[model samples]
Target: MDQSLKSPGQSALEDAFHAMFELTRTKPAPTLAERLDRLARLRALIANNESRFEKVISADFGHRCATETAIAETLLVLGEIKHAAKHLKKWMTPQRVPTALQFLPAKNRLIPQPLGVVGIIAPWNYPLQLTLAPAVGAIAAGNRVMIKPSELVPRFSALLKEVISTKFDATEIVVTGIEDDISQAFASLPFDHLIFTGSTRVGRLVAEAAGRNLTPITLELGGKSPAIVDRSADLGEAAERIAYAKLVNAGQTCIAPDYALVPEASVQDFAEKVQASMRRMFGTDPANKDYTSIVSDRHYQRLESLVTDAAAKGARIVQAAKPDDPAWKTKRKFPPTIVIGVTPDMTIMQEEIFGPLLPILGYKDATEPVSYINRHGRPLALYWFGKDNATRDEVLARTVSGGVTVNDCLFHFTQINQPMGGIGASGTGAYHGEWGFNNLSKLKPVFYRSPFNRLADLYPPYGAKISRLEKMLRFMS
Candidate 1:
């Protein structure tokens, strides 16, 4: 692309990168007071504009419930800011470590320092939380940030850009909502560190682009996260919790339960209970108050294609709410759907169903679900619901996922102290609380020698004295 023809977003991103790079060269890391000031400004900006966030996000989605935005986007970011503010002092302190036995009387410490510039590519599902939560961590760690929010949610992105422009300087925290070409261009920049949260497909592109610059990256990619219901589990409570987690944001969350594994005999009963739970939450018609629409027509059609393909491939499709009338086609709202008799050959079974679709498969033993989860790439989140400690421990010990929630769903994400991220294809590295601070900072190691050090005897040409000392050490060993 020609430089003159570059989109404004692309131009601004290039400018921000240069500006931040220059700023960091002069002021490599902000002081504790400066960082706290930036965080305070961010908190004030979001807290004061809660209503605007709700309104803009609702406009971006056809009809997003205000409370959902309050809890997921605005409130979650606020919590992250408060948590970072409280812990930044401790997290920034140098950690003293014991020196190895070979280096007696030497001092060792790990000092945390900020990386120069960080780039965050946010996803559309939870735009505010994904975009600003990372910024909070970066600022707390004293790094400059450039955010490229998803273009699918235009109103929310514009509003976010406005908020950032008003409250933050470009070199401090820059935000952009650009076209795909510009996003690709932004991803190619040589940032000190970068974080991208989206599909594995696009995450691959971003990862490849960053790799060219040797930029360290954290890719929060999606996968088929599973929930297992052991035979000894409470079926009704499990169904209700799983339904609420899966249907929130219309199953747009990256960590939402993608499928459920139930004991063979209770499959039908569990499915019925999930249906009832959905009805209680969103009535028979799945009214707008609690249900959220698909983000775009393209995503809606892709979800529709998955359903049609699964149904054609001998899968039993069931709605969690009411009839799957065609009227929902125009409204862009899809019901919480359930699928049974799902086989690996079906499209729904293969892809990460990011919409309001759930597939329940039956397993004969506790080991089967573990084996199934192991066969696929590691998931971002896994859920296990049961009273049996043996089964819970077995699953936890056997399966590898980014995180786990027991007897419920998504509560693991709410714990700010724990790190949230994926392993293998799902994601790498974690970000939250103190972990977020350390992940974004370079913990440099320092070793100090005392003035009375006696190591000079071993430094020369390994003479008789060194040989004698080595022999004495060997005898002690």
Candidate 2:
């Protein structure tokens, strides 16, 4: 569609898309030096504006923890850039495959080529990492990139646009406006690939739109990712890790342990330990700098409704702080809460709890956790804390998830060599390090045939030679 005929935000998105699309068409493959330079510039952009990014991201969140921002956003992004730059050369090189004995002297090479113009639709939570991490791969793969950051983080989005614009030509890379009108149009563009990181509900819409253009998509969607506390696991250690993972960014993390499945005998003790850990780390104080506020009033209310519904349904409400206290609500910081005696009927159990709320459910035996998880949609991440190698291996083998982190929480995402993505409803496709580069590039297979081959003899009129050729093929098979 023409820019003049569309909404202002849509028009701007169209302009950016066309510009990068045209550039990619003209210069399809970017040299190794060019890719490394882009990665370096991106690193510098984050490094130079570390404080500014932190400040705006916090402002967007009402009050995000500075340490969390540094560790989760800035530091992770820097690590990705460093990793991509270091391994890009090897990733770009083609691999040789063995040729068939019948086609002697012929060769097979899988060449990696740039897929032009990759579009990224980033979610508000972990905005920086989700937005630029994919770009690192696209850039390393030699594709022009476009990003549409969430409108929820307007301050960070605007700043990102400003900084990215200064470092890159619009045709090389562009951060489009986050205005509402731009959103629907952004997904409809025919890009070589599209990546959307958010809830599964919206992921469906993005996937549907991308399907129309036959645009390949990578969805990093969230679901009710669970952490199982095995009978053999240390209660204190498991509680501490799950507590930190759940409360980080006030549990807005996509892979945050949505609930804990503990053995029936240890459920109460484990839940209390987790509550203690939450108090020890972030504390009950509404003004605690370590605690983060909910992103907006709407999200805050949704969380409140979940708690209220759970309480009304007869579940025990365990709070690190006084739940009725006005201080937490006033600051938009939900009191660190844990819900117990939760049944499948409760609203909290039905949906992805993207808040600081953790529901502790007891399992009858080791087999129950695996069976329960199997009954639901596949989750993006699953964590099992235990020392029992046999039991752990059984759970790992029986259930499927996008990724698994045994004995810890959220560490699977930090491994640069590993592919970070979800499976089924939680998400689709994977990317990080070489996985990202390969996902963004087309690994085209090229076969070289030698002129001296006699296979063409069978292509003519049928004769006794044809029978001989059939016998040879059968022998090879």
Candidate 3:
């Protein structure tokens, strides 16, 4: 907040922001060929640097499964690239709009124009995917990009610098390492558009900073995402899907199932099924080669404390995997845990448990689950496991979240065609495919008229034609 503390680096950052604006404003708009070329270059960059990205993520996390990195990070980024490339032209096309009868002889259309430089602030979890995914959309919209990867993932951040520097011009796309001061300065810059992915606390800061400049922002933030399991749902399948999602990235994902609302009658059965699924997935030894470790010990300790505190408060702590289990004692490893009989006062129920701790709250009926979700601040994602179409529809209609998956979790985010973002407390704005392009571009309305058809009668001040035009407007209305 202090300008006096602003270092030369901060001054350079500001200059960079101004230079980007100048470049976008002064340079001729990119041709379709140039946009296509940029996409190709980005694709090549991701493909060529895939291995390096994986290695960097693995090094940063110290136990990130190579396969997980490839699937979650590499595949996701590549998929976004493919989606953006396939839809870029369609998204960029100026859409013709029907002119009102009142505005006769005029043609109107919505033109999609780039918003110049866009600043993307990415999160530490899934660092490569989150950072590059939005970048794909920003580039497809024909806007320059500046990326600030989280400091927690220093290795991947460094790798991004290398990859982006080699693949893109500084004025086109640039990646910067995380410095608190630099990040603050970067967020405060008057970018044409800014997209941030992080926690709600930081999202507020980013939104405030963007507000100061009257710049538009897309905030992708996380909250206590909940999974609802009804009486009619398949307990086994629901448990398996929930466990799989909860363990993915050791539950560091923004859209991971934070907790669950289960039918009271099926609570015990659901817990057993979840535990069985955990055992099956990790082979009773999650610390083995296949499973992932927590990103840091701090996260592990926080998870441990949450479990400890909940258990102390008379909540039932059900260990899907035991403490003596290989998964438990391993460095940065917290086994899939479930806390039942959880009251609203419990820590597990109150906070966004960004770990593999799934708290199950028993409910009397489907309505209770919907009510519970609605009572809480909307989450980044919501999950429902039910075969009944009516039940699924009911849940979908009743609950609000950034995204939803009918019988699974986190997969909805994979669909680039649909808009992905939070409502209310979860976050704001969406970015993916066409939505992402639109987020980074301004849809300016354009109107054209033929001089030959200009209506002179309506142009006169308070003439008899005005009454006639008013009648016509009333009729149209």
Candidate 4:
């Protein structure tokens, strides 16, 4: 990495990292007051520009739902900032731990220290929330932050950069350019910690680059998260909730239910209910502002292909809009589609469907869904819907996912106290509220030795006295 041959984006990134690294060395731990001030500035930045952010994000997506942006992006970030600001003092305090009886006179404490500069690589979906929420935790832990917003949402990314520049110093918190060169170089920087939110395919690249620098990462990747509809579950209730979750961002959500698993007898009924629910919520019009369009033409075409592939493979394609409807294609609005009788070989079932398309699969018994999920890579989120406590408990215990909502979808992520992350193929590491604070902060343990402790007597000079102590220790154990 010679400076002379480096791209402008790489050079700028190196400069930013060096400046922030130097600042961390000079003033590593910011005071409580300083941290609170930073949080306040972030709060004001979001509050003052809420409307503008909504508009820019919509422009980026062609037609992003305004209410969805407010709820999923702006509101979530504001809530995270408020949570971090309120409980920061308690979160930052050192904790006491019990000492072993062998070292009874010593004291043990765990201190939380900042991890210096944190880098966040955000995706275009929910750009504001995904980018700033992790920064909230890093800032709360008193660390400098650098964010690389998605290139897909150029308007939103540029607006974020300009507004962030106005409120904070570059070294304190900066938004990097979303150039291709910048994106490629961002993960390679030797950050103290990195947070990436995107598909599993790109998460691997980011993780590999970060691994070279031994930088810790919190990856929020997507997967084929499933919604299990138990036989005892209320079909109407489950359908409405899952439908809302699937269509919220036009199914661009990472944790959105990728497919549904219903009992064999109820498969057709559940599919109809879900389709009806989708129509009721978003309606049959592509021009409906309440409905959001796919982020780009490429993404829209991909969704169309998934539906086409499923249909060609003998899977039922239920849609509110016809496949060749020019209105939907021109507007980049993907018709809410439900795929029935999807087989494992279908491309739609083989990959994560980050669109409004939902595949409805039927299971023979309670154990079939669990086994099916286990056979594939673990999902980022899992949804179980049923009133039977025994069945719900069994499903929860048998399945291993990043997180779970017992009878709902996407609600677990909103709980600030809970860790929002995935496992294995879904993601690696967790963050949100105290979980985020602790993950970004190093919990260094401090042990205080008392002058009167007798443990030193057993060091070296082995003899009868040490032998007698060992015998006593064995007896105690």
- lDDT (tens digit, per residue) of candidate 1 on 223-295: 9999999998999999999999999998999999999999999999999999889888876564557788888
Candidate 2 per-residue lDDT over residues 1-477, each given as its tens digit: 654689877877787898888877886598999999999999999999999999999999999999999999889989999989989889888998999988888889999999999999999989898899999999999999999999999999999999999999998889988877788899999999999999999999999999999999999998999999999999999999999999999999999999999999998899889989999999878999999999998999999899999999999999866544688877889999999999999999999999999999998977999999999999999999999999999999999998999999999999999999999999989999999999999999999888997778788798988899889988988
Q: Pairing residues by index, what is the TM-score of model 4?
A: 0.98
Candidate lDDT scores, in order, read 0.88, 0.92, 0.84, 0.93
What's the ranking of the predictions by lDDT, best on top?
Answer: 4, 2, 1, 3
Residue pairs whose backbone atoms clash in candidate 4: none
TM-score rank order: 4, 2, 1, 3
Write down the worst ten-residue block by lDDT for model 3.
Answer: 320-329
- List residue ranges in candidate 3 displaced over 4 A: 1-5, 320-330, 452-455
RMSD of each: 1.8, 1.2, 1.9, 1.0
Tell me the tens digit of each residue's lDDT in model 3 across 1-477. 476777877866777777788999899667667888888898899898888887888788877888888888889888888888887778788999998877768889999988899999999889888888888888888899998889888989988888788877888888765888788788888888889999998999899989999989889999999899877788999999999999888788999999988989889999989988987887556556667778876777788889988999998887756544554656566777888888988878888999888888888866898888888899899998887888889888888788989889999998878998998878888988888888888899998875755366578687787898778779999
How high is the lDDT of residue 89 in model 1? 89
Which residue pairs in candidate 1 collide? Answer: none
Q: Please, what is the TM-score per model?
A: 0.96, 0.98, 0.96, 0.98
Identify the leading candidate in terms of lDDT.
4
